[model samples]
Target: MQTFTLNDGNKIPAIGFGTFQIPSDGSTYKAVSAALKLGYRHIDTAVAYFNEGEVGQAVRDSGIPRDEIWVTSKLWLQDYGEEPAKKAIDLSLKKLGLDYVDLYLIHQPYGDVPGAWRAMEAAKQAGKIKSIGVSNMTPKIWQQFVPQFDTLPSVNQVEFNPYFQQTALRQILAKNDVKLEAWAPLGQGNQDLFKEPILNGLAEKYNKNVGQIILRFENQEGIIVFPKSVHEARIKSNLDIFDFELTADEVAQIRTLDTGKGMHDPDAPGVGDMLLSGVRFDNVAQKDSQKSNR
Candidate 1:
């Protein structure tokens, strides 16, 4: 796998397997194990995902050495204060069954993010987390937070893809020496991304899938991507992107697809309220149960 150097001089795999929507129904274990078997060294999860234990169990059962795999988890919105953030890190470590996570992120910009960042820096000093970052933060948030911190974030994971190109945000991150990590790198398969004409042509020419073509483009753009797939064939295919490179013309062709929109906008009014309004552990449990029944 290709790798990028973080601001702290840590190397992160350019491509990873994301567990954002991994069903809580033991499927995360199977998916993670499959991803590891397919040569994915980076696994991105979060406490809010509610499947950290399963991901940890899968890593253990895979028989891969703990240090060989890179695990990333996030502190949730509710756990935003200094004390709460510190406690959240401990809980995340316990849930992940790891001594220290390779990468830890503040899940959102809401709540007491400045206090949480302070806690994150303290955790880094305490050797509890190797590196710390933020997710779903915009340029405005970073401008406010970055200046106040002695240590800048090593990464900023957000909803990036061909559609939401994030040009300005990327510039800010580059200026600060923070790497960009893409959560929905494939735009959640929106609007037939796999069937797009330009991508299809490139896929045929390169003998790869449209998804692989898209991933390859993003990789060349210097953005770290975590594309999730529970299907074995798809997972293997996603990892196959390392063997090819996209041409400049092909990259330009793909750039025309940007719509500058995110599926979820954290900056929108009432967005934070909407996210927490209907969320419940019981709802997660019921959703998991339904998936299992299916």
Candidate 2:
């Protein structure tokens, strides 16, 4: 697997297996274990996904050296304060059954981000997290929020794809030496993307699928990508992108498909409220009780 050197001097795999929206009912363990077995050395997970425990178990049992596999998890918005962030980091480590993570990110831009970042910095200093960064951060948020800290984030994971290229934010992140990591790198399975003639033509030319073309495009652009899948064939295919290389003209052809629109806009009105309603430390027990009552 190719690795990208982070601003913090740490290396992260160019392609990782994403675990967003992957349920914890043995599915996560199965998928992650399969990914590891198929030569995926990088795994991305989060507390918000509620599958950290399974992801941890898969890595622990994969028989691969822990240091050789790069594992990343994020801190949730509910755990945003300094003290709460401390506990949240510890909880993630506990759930992951690992002493530390390769990368730890602030999952969302809402809440007391400064406090959470401070706690993350302390954790990094204490050897609990190797590299720390943010997710879903827009250019405005990145400008205002990141300058307050001395340690620039090693990477910023966000929504990046052909349709929503995040051109402006990428420039800002580049100026600061923060690498870009794509979450919905496949455009969240948008049908239009798969139907695009450019991608289809490239797919045919390279003897790869549309997904592989997109992943290779991003990989050539110096961006890290995490493409998610639970199906065995898809999991194996997603990682089969390192062999082919896209030409400069071919990459430019795909760049023409950028629509400058994203599926989720962090700057949209009421997004903060919607995010806050997702999960919280104070409401976990109540939510569990409600789930059981159902």
Best by lDDT: 2
Candidate 1 C-alpha lDDT tens digits along 1-294: 789999899999999999998876688999999999989999999878888878888888889998889999988877788997898787777776678899999887876788999999999888899999999988877776678777889999999888889988999988878999998898898867767899899999999888898899999999999899899999998889988889899899999988888888777898767655535443453343344333
Q: So what's the TM-score on candidate 1?
A: 0.92
148 Cα displacement, candidate 1 (Å): 2.4
Which regions of candidate 2 deviate over 4 angstroms? Answer: 281-294
Query: What TM-score do all the candidates reach, one by one?
Result: 0.92, 0.95
Which lDDT values do the candidates have, in the order given?
0.85, 0.90
lDDT score, candidate 2, position 19:
97
- Quality of model 2 by C-alpha lDDT: 0.90
After TM-score superposition, the amount by which residue 183's alpha carbon in candidate 2 deviates from its true location, in angstroms, is 0.9
